[model samples]
Target: MPPVNASREPMTLPRLTEDPVSPLSPGTHTITVRHGLSRIEQRYHVAGTGPVCIAHPGGPGIGWEYLRMPQLERSLTMVYIEPVGTGASGFLADPRAYTVTTYAHFLRAVIEHLALPDVVLLGHSHGGFVAQRYALDQPERVEALVLYDTSPVTGEEFWSAAVANLERFVQRHVDERPEVARYVAALTTRLDQLTDEGATAVLRTIMPAYVCDYWGREEEFGPARRSLRMYAAPTRGDGQPFDVRDELSAVAAPTLVLVGSDDFICGPHWARMIHQGIPEAQLTVLDETGHLAHLERPEEFRSVMTGFLALEREDAH
Candidate 1:
């Protein structure tokens, strides 16, 4: 799909292969799993080949395509989860049930259904919150953890700091890139009101700020912005805001904290907090990058990931 304006001709997508030796065999797989009393469809795309790595994409409402990592896929079998309410996945009966904990429940089912006694868990952005909760709640299941472009907690402090940083970013670009102010405004607006299609439009416009230099590299990243599919997921919840700062120290799996230095929301501040909280955690701050480090600097991101995974595997022996 190329942008919202483009026609989405109905087309077929791949499904789980028949009579596979292992469920993780390199291809698409869809399984209906239990999350409490709710029967949900957990559809995941499989690619690459190596140790099983369950990659959870963010957006609680956003589509999973943006998190695709052909780079990391080379060394790790990337199982890209198309989370609930997204394409091919079942929707929640109670929209309010779309919290991180609910997501973790479904994620656990996916791992269990795959019969993965231990698997590497990678979560990005909102998905990171889910990963942390999942890893913290069930430490034994996860072999290692990758928390990318996310924060340990998101509450008053997180929002206030992000607003301050985003204001700075807007002011910096106010003179040269006048349109950035508009984009920033759109980004901060009452996003909860936006429909799924409306969310897609807003996300495309604000996609530039997500990178260190989107306009400079528009040719490279423009396609991603245009093609981004978004669903308006329940963001503002009545439940307590995501906070795992205190619980991070108890995390058993070796963790890697990845964040873009210039990321307005999950910048150096939160990344540092996460680093300090997790004992022996490796923190990689990609300078001159924003929210999407993998998109901004694929090679560097991939190198660090592969290196860390290899080291962890070596240490396991």
Candidate 2:
């Protein structure tokens, strides 16, 4: 993959930032922290007094903004953050520096900095990978794990499907706008060059295709479409090839793996695999839904999550 934001100059941006429409109640104070010279920062949106839940974005570089997951925020004090190189967070100059382990470390830092206990991690897509890894590494820190539309890990076996889908997605976008094919190709190729910061720029340009068939409200879809476009600029020429299947047993947290029944990307079967791997995990297949289950069916998503959280609360009591 090529770099999405490389074409533009790299500047030092705010290490941590706040969301304009935080799901947390007004007057709540959230903190952002910068650790080390790298631009990897964490954004905390604190509210509610029950337990702490950290929300990780999916794309390797996409920030937490795309996922408002307001339902979860309303129930628990939620912390949404930009991965190493996306959003208001600074980008690592080294593209190789962008790996799942480092991202998980950053997540740990956020949890420790906030001094949160009984932390429940809710990660979507790529973020799920992070949450899974974090649980495996720091099982004691995590109270529960919510894997939203992602597998325990991904590898050569899964790359074929992802590659095929991405190729089709890119082809469709290029077909929609032939003139931009070269740019699209270039951007996708540039995915590798992207330090984490460049990932957001790339996603903003190319992520829309995934949602072309998902959202009903064009108004709602419009912003999502724009987000996809930005991320599209960075291409994974060979795609990502890493597996965490062996680490599944290491996750001691009670896990809940949710999937959209109609998710073309990470379907229900994948969710089942996660449930089977994590001995304590529960799987829920959301019928008639797609990849963006939270956005597509917010109310149902909220209900499912709330029920799970409530269960955990009861068990704790």
Candidate 3:
């Protein structure tokens, strides 16, 4: 890994062409980051200006499309990162380099490459883990943090509870919700045998379990099969029992921990754990929301996010 003060060479972004069909025009840029002994390209999309907020999506491998919330563009430039080994990004030679620490390092390289003095990191699910680690590692470079549907740690206790919750959810809705039951069973059975293609398929099948309005708003889930290579990367060792609870206090950035009340995976328990672990982090548990709170409740999520950003700016002066 490069030193904190390592000189970053300028990387040019692709020219943006006007798209009359779309309301927002985002510019795509890619930067090369040296991970362990392998060099990989990290792709990211940039939109809007003012202050920069780098957004990392969950799945560890999922594409950043789901997080391209237009409301955030009104106030801050949202930079959506496509982690290495996924999307147009370069493939990793060593899968072991897919650890959270490596992801944080990749983020730092992106920030440095872009010449961003300070940034606000918005990480969803697994991305939250990366953002937290990044903020802790580079406190001086991170102005604020938004941890959405993520946990401070993913140790045995967390996974045990998550499994228990899934089991209970299954037992309660198995007969009434056949789709949910099938998806849960599939995930439980096929997790070890997941392939790049099968990964996204399984994820889409189980999407309902992660949303609050899955029953009625199932159509809203849409197609999200883009990057699934990173799914296996995490399990390789980078995300095995991922734990960083003891390091939360080292983060100096103003933090917001957002989660859905109905998020069975990283629910209120993880949210409270993060809030209490951080010195003064704010926690918001959105009702009628699930793992995909931003997607499930865009209006409320936007208000909460924009309000926090505004407050952070207000306190700066």
Candidate 4:
């Protein structure tokens, strides 16, 4: 990775299929996995064999391209997957297929397919919703959880913030490519309808905090470039819909709730709620950061994660 430059926008995203080396450590394979299904492809980078770390991307149509998994992957065999219609994964025309519960099933299949034992499920934002559901469905499969900037409850507040962001983004695009902007505008409007189908595009816009500002290959303006590409992508078919707050208390895995003190969408209050509800969950808020705490504070992120891994290993004995 190049050094950070505050002047120019980042170049186009790196082809995630290529094997990229980690800066923190060496000896890792960053490759793509081909599932039989056309839309089932997953991209991951693996390092050590101590534990399996599976990460879910934040948005409906975005992949885990810019995520700071290299640090973690260098520590363990890390897996980061792009959902259908985003990143390296196959695209789908149906947006309704991106629901929370069905995503859990995908996660379960990935775990079983990989033949992993005692997995660590780490999710950010929307991924947290899926992680929560996965732990509820297959408690025994997960060894630990690290949730960053996730909401404990879902409703208008979430959609409202999403719509607002989309509106601003659409306005910027209107000048550059009116046709694409119009198409995106239609999708954004559909989001206000709040149907399962419309929610997918809106979800795409809501994710990817401007505060994160990390685009892997991009030295600067990485977040802005990524946000633009994400807006134009299509969504996947919808999946099952259900809230898991009532079921959160049943999560058996040791969890670490990592959050940004300045995160507006999923604020400290939500973190506290999740920490209070989960029997073995702990919350840590990063100061002076917004939604993407991991990127804003990568060293801190690794510190908390590595420490928790040590604690879990010690407890297992």
Score each candidate by Cα lDDT.
0.78, 0.62, 0.71, 0.59
lDDT of 3 by residue, 21-77 (tens): 322236777667877676788778777766778898776656556666666777778
lDDT for predicted candidate 4 compared with the true structure: 0.59
- What is candidate 2's lDDT per residue for 228-277, written digit by digit as tens? 41332212322456467776877888788998876656767678888878
Model 2 residue 248 lDDT?
84
Which structure is stronger by TM-score: 2 or 4?
2
Predict model 1's lDDT versus the native.
0.78
Q: What digit string (tens of lDDT, one per residue) describes model 4 on residues 1-317?
A: 00011211232422333544441122323233333343455444344444678777666544455454555655776676555555455543445545676567666766765676768888887788888888888888899998878876666665465445545655755585454354334434533235433443343343333343233334444444434334223234352333567778998999999888766566677788899889979889888776765556768888989899889989989
Q: 3 or 4, which is superior by lDDT?
A: 3
Ranked by lDDT, the better of candidates 2 and 3 is 3
lDDT, candidate 3, residue 316? 98
Worst 10 residues of 4 by lDDT: 1-10
Strongest candidate by TM-score: 1
Clashing pairs in 1: 59-62
- Model 4 — TM-score against the truth? 0.70
What does candidate 1's lDDT look like per residue over 1-317, in tens digits? 11111111211223334334567877667788877787788788787778988988886677776777777777888887878877778887777788888889889888888887888999988888989999998899999999998888887888778777768888878798887877656766665677888877887777766778777887777767777777765543334688999889999999999988888877788888889999999999998988877677889999989899999999999
Between prediction 2 and prediction 3, the one with superior TM-score is 3
